[model samples]
Target: MNFFYFAYGSNMLALRLQKRCPSAVFVESATAEGYAVNFSKLGRDASGKGALFEKQKSTALGVVFEIAKSDLKSLDKAEGVWFGYDRRTDFEVVTNSGETIETTTYLPPKMDIQLQPFGWYLALVVAGAIENGLPQDYINKLKSTPYQIDENQNRPSRLDALETLKSTGHSNWQDLFTSPRAS
Candidate 1:
């Protein structure tokens, strides 16, 4: 069996998601109405990660992926289900073509408003949005989100994500480092 998963953060990048869930396959671009993307989830490295916040009259755009049921455990482990996020399946997202689909997604167990995402993390999100052909306005919004540079220059995860973005031929990948909103 396969399941639909909606990705609104770095996982929206196919390359990034594939590393965690090998069976993930892009389905379509979708929108979760009444939600907003925020970088307020506390990450293991003391940085902020992406999370969805419910906001009336707002919409959060993302990509829907079809992943094999067998890989659910792997996804759970990668998402740190025990502490980082709570997996939920009750969300309904509308695809670009007006089709509504019930999909699973992860939400932070708690939010810290003072946290901000690392530059590399947010870049992965912006790159994914561009790679998936999401709306320009939405992309711009993501790009404009404030981010902080990881002082640990040799962080393995950050290195790997930047390498993937470069290897994948994302033309503006370098710009992400220079153009983020003032931290």
Candidate 2:
């Protein structure tokens, strides 16, 4: 049994998502209308993470993956469903081929506009967007999002994510940390 999962944040990265749910398989690029992606979800690391918020006439572009039902618990754990995101199954996204698909996604319980994502975290998202061939304009918007540098240079997750991006052949991944817009 499998279910479609919509990934708009770091989970959009195939390698990243696969680590959590090994059965995850990329399906297609999708768009959720009337919503916008924002880095306003408070993360366990005290940095902002991506969340979708209702916005008039806006759309959030992302990737869809088919995940095994047996791995749902692992996916929930990775998403911090207990304290972070609320798993939503009511969302409907349109694929590039103009087909409407019912999918599940994660949404923050609350939003904090003042928060900003860590540079490395945002890099994961941008790299994922590029890997999935999302719209160029959407990728540019993601790059323009403000981010803060992690004070801990040796953060394990940060190192792992950046390394994953590099290993996935994202040559300019390092440049993503260079000039993040001020939060």
Candidate 3:
């Protein structure tokens, strides 16, 4: 069986998704019309609470990927869908090609996410924002987002991690992993 997933958050970081599902195929760029993507209250964990992706009626750009049935469960776990998200077949047509697909979009079932403009999860939201052509001002807001404290100190926002890299003068994290360091 084939499943279509609409990735609006960090999943736009292709490498991240590739790690989760090696066979995942990128289909095309699409948008969720009448909806806007925001990182808001997701849930709490030992590390810290997080802001998850939420869709409002303002349209957000996204990518669709085809995943194998065997990989869906793993992907769900990686996404923390086990807690905040409930997989559903209620997805609608967002493609100009008139293709209807069902996708696993994460949402809050209990309460609406109260928007925190500088939340830590904004870093994870960056990949999606950049892909969707969100304005530079918004991008800067994401880049400068401040970390929040939950129950733990280890669960800093993605921006905080990136800032740590910047402070350590290792601004290029991609290079740290992808490049051979000086011997």
Which digits, one per residue and each the tens of the lDDT, describe model 2 over residues 123-161?
999889888998777787898888998998799888888
Model 1 TM-score relative to the real fold: 0.93
Pairs that collide, model 3: 34-57, 34-58, 35-56, 35-58, 35-59, 36-56
Instruction: Give candidate 3's whole-model lDDT.
Output: 0.56
lDDT of candidates 1 onward, in order: 0.89, 0.89, 0.56
Q: Report the C-alpha lDDT of model 1 over 1-183, residue by residue, as the tens digit.
A: 999999999999999999989999999999999999999999898999999989899999999999999989998887879778999987899999999999999988789989999988998998899889998778878887888889998999888888878877755565854654433
Per-residue C-alpha lDDT of model 3 across residues 63-145, encoded as one tens digit per residue:
77788889888887876665766665566547646566667665544444453433334344555455545556645555544
Candidate 3: 10-residue stretch with minimal lDDT: 174-183
Pairs of residues clashing in candidate 1: none
Model 3: what TM-score? 0.62
Candidate 2 wrong stretches, greater than 4 Å: 177-183
Model 2 residue 13 CA deviation (Å) reads 1.0
RMSD of each: 2.9, 3.1, 7.7
Listed in order, each prediction's TM-score against the native is: 0.93, 0.93, 0.62
Q: CA lDDT of 64 in candidate 1? A: 98
**Weakest ten-residue segment in model 2 by summed lDDT:** 174-183
Q: Model 2 Cα displacement at 77 (Å)?
A: 0.7
